[model samples]
Target: MEKRNKILNIEQIHTYYGVSHVIQGLSMYIEEQETVSILGRNGVGKTTTLRSIMGLTPPQSGTINIDGIDTSRWQPHKISKIGVAYVPAERHIFPGLTVEENLKLAARPGNGKDAWTFERVCDHFPVLAERTNQDGATLSGGEQQMLAISRALISNPRIIIMDEPSQGLSPLLVQMITDVVLKFCIKSGITMLIVEQNYRMALKVATRHYLMDTKGEIVKVASTRELVDDPEIIQSHLSV
Candidate 1:
């Protein structure tokens, strides 16, 4: 088999919030076009891991490389400019702007070959298209989540970092988000690093899973199929 290039690499990263030590020597890598997930209970630094990668909270030590460039110290906008898009748990859309405006404002010009155009994003997310003129604050939670993802896609990112994409939604909406990831992202060859509390939804979209311990260390890394078959592993690491 051919070896795939590493699109994102995190080596021995330690992050802190003021005096609170969060991530402790965490290291992981995602190969090109692979959808990898970090799964753990609440407050396990899964979101911190994504934030560290995107330079939202730069690791005090260690290194992060994106597309062969060292981005450990880069600012958030600089990181985004280099083809990394982040969808946070907050769903931070501009409440005053229409859905179409939100997507348009996030778009960046892509290389002609694989560019994700406004029309293309709307096509993939038809609900966003239907609500083009609606203000972001007026949309339902699921619609807001869809808009968030659509905004990320509009930026034409090579990799997308999603933190808890399935949180606080109906089961039907969770399934819809899963389908969007599988059908639109996976098929489009977009590399995704997802931090999810919903293990079932994460398993449905990701090929590999990394389970984090309470101290913010990776305790287990396994193929999704292997982990799925071993209820003991899931129970031991992820169960409440």
Candidate 2:
């Protein structure tokens, strides 16, 4: 059997916000080209997990290895330089910039190979091509989400971390975003760690699922097939 490369590894990370303790000794790993979803109720440190990995909120004690290099103490910009892209839930595109401009600003030849060009990203998201001149603030929520994902892709990241990609969208738009993500995963073969409250949509894109409890601990990790067949697991961990 061929060995799978571990692209991202988080082990025993403890993060805190001021005096409030969160993300108590959380550990997880994502293999290359794999899509893993972290599911939990709101405020279970789902967002914090991503933030910790990105160095936005550094963990006080833990090791984050990216491609076998320890990066727990690396700054967020340094992390990005190593081919890690983060798309937060807020979809923080430059509101005043044109859609094309936003993508241009984020374009980079990551790792000095397999760089994503403007044309390629536009091909991946044709809607973005049509709205090239539109201001980032003018696009609809779904469009803004696309732009955000596109901005990340333009960086040619090895792994993409997303927070609630499907939040606040209509069912049709959700399905559309899912399709885009699935296609991107299939084509690019880039690893992803997504934190989502939309269980159905997350399940659709992720091959593996990690269930987090209220205390920010990952209580279970299972294949998507297993989790989909077991609603009790979802109910026990995710239901209000």
Candidate 3:
């Protein structure tokens, strides 16, 4: 299939955490209706790259284009209004609120008038519906991650940037999360950029992949088949 139009265009983002340069010239793009994965070891600028695109950690220099509009200068909320959603690695949920409440806060329109509803999100994760009244703090790591994603879906974004969606989950739950992401890309035609350390899970869900080295630089970009078949690239850049 010919690739869809680019939904996100992140070009040469240079970001810093105080005096430390974290992300150096990182560039990547997410095409509409496609699934892309950002693979790297810890502290390889994966999180920083997501943050830069989200405007939480603004880049000193870069161009962030969402559906063709350059939004590098926009604030986080403004960028979000342009149809981009971000789910951080930390799983930011309102600990005091119930799962239902969290989703309500994140709710927005999707492509047209047919946006995501609370029932639809619960249907995606039936377990969430079962625990609708449960407090966020009480949910398991995997459940929290589910809520994080459901929250993003409520926004009906064109492209969702996920930072470590599989972090700290049991193997079973990791599979669940991966399944949901793939379903979204296939069924809903939602574009996504996921940052994950679990190579196998990432490969299964991603159409294309990009690897960031320890220096916060993009080292490799390939199709999922190329990524998984070529073990040398993983050994060279991501071996622990």
Candidate 4:
């Protein structure tokens, strides 16, 4: 049997927002080329888990390892240097800048021939190519989401972490975004750790799912087959 390479690992993380306890002893991991999703009702520390992994909100305890190196004490930029990229839910593009400017601003030269070059990413997202001169904030919600995701890919990360890629989009747009992510997982083999409210979309793209409860801990873990075979799991934990 082939060995699995862990791209990201979290063990017993506890994070807090000004003494308000959250992310109590949450632990999870993603292997290389794996796509994992964390699902739950709102305000259940899903985003906080992603934040903890990225070093945005450092865990008060436990360890975070990326590519086998402990990064619990690293800064967000330092984490990015070690091949972790993030596409936050807010779609934080510079409103005053053009699409081209935004991509260039976040660009870190990737590896080798198949690396995600400016032309390559633009080719992957022709809508962005056509609107290169347009200010980021002026674009429609779907377009902005595309730009946000493109920014992450252009960095050519070992793993990409996304928070609510489907939030605030229409059903049609949500499906479109889902298709984009599915393609990334199939073609690029990019590892992903996603926190999403749209479990249907998440399940479609993720090979594994984590069911987080109100207490900020993982109560259940399932493979796509396991969860699909047992709809009751979704209904019991994920349903509102």
lDDT for model 2:
0.90
Residue 28 local lDDT, model 3: 86
Which stretches in model 2 have alpha-carbon errors above 4 Å?
110-114
TM-score of each: 0.97, 0.96, 0.94, 0.97
- Runs of candidate 1 with Cα error greater than 4 angstroms are none
- What is the per-residue lDDT of model 2 for residues 1-240, given as tens digits with 9 covering 90 to 100? 788999998899999999888999899999999899999998999999999999999999989999999999999999999999999999998988999999999998754445688988887788999999999999999999999988988888889899999999999999998988888753687899899999999889999999998787899998988987888988888899
Better of 1 and 2 by TM-score: 1
Q: What do the candidate models score in CA lDDT, each in turn?
A: 0.90, 0.90, 0.85, 0.89
Candidate 3 per-residue lDDT, tens place, 140-222, comes to 88989889988988898888888888888889999989888877544677788889899888888888999889889898898
Regions of candidate 3 where Cα sits further than 4 Å from its true position: 1-3, 111-114
lDDT of 4 by residue, 179-227 (tens): 8888754468789988888888988999999999998999999998998
TM-score of 3: 0.94
Consecutive 10-residue window with the lowest summed lDDT within model 2: 108-117
Model 1 local distance difference test score: 0.90
Question: lDDT of candidate 4?
Answer: 0.89
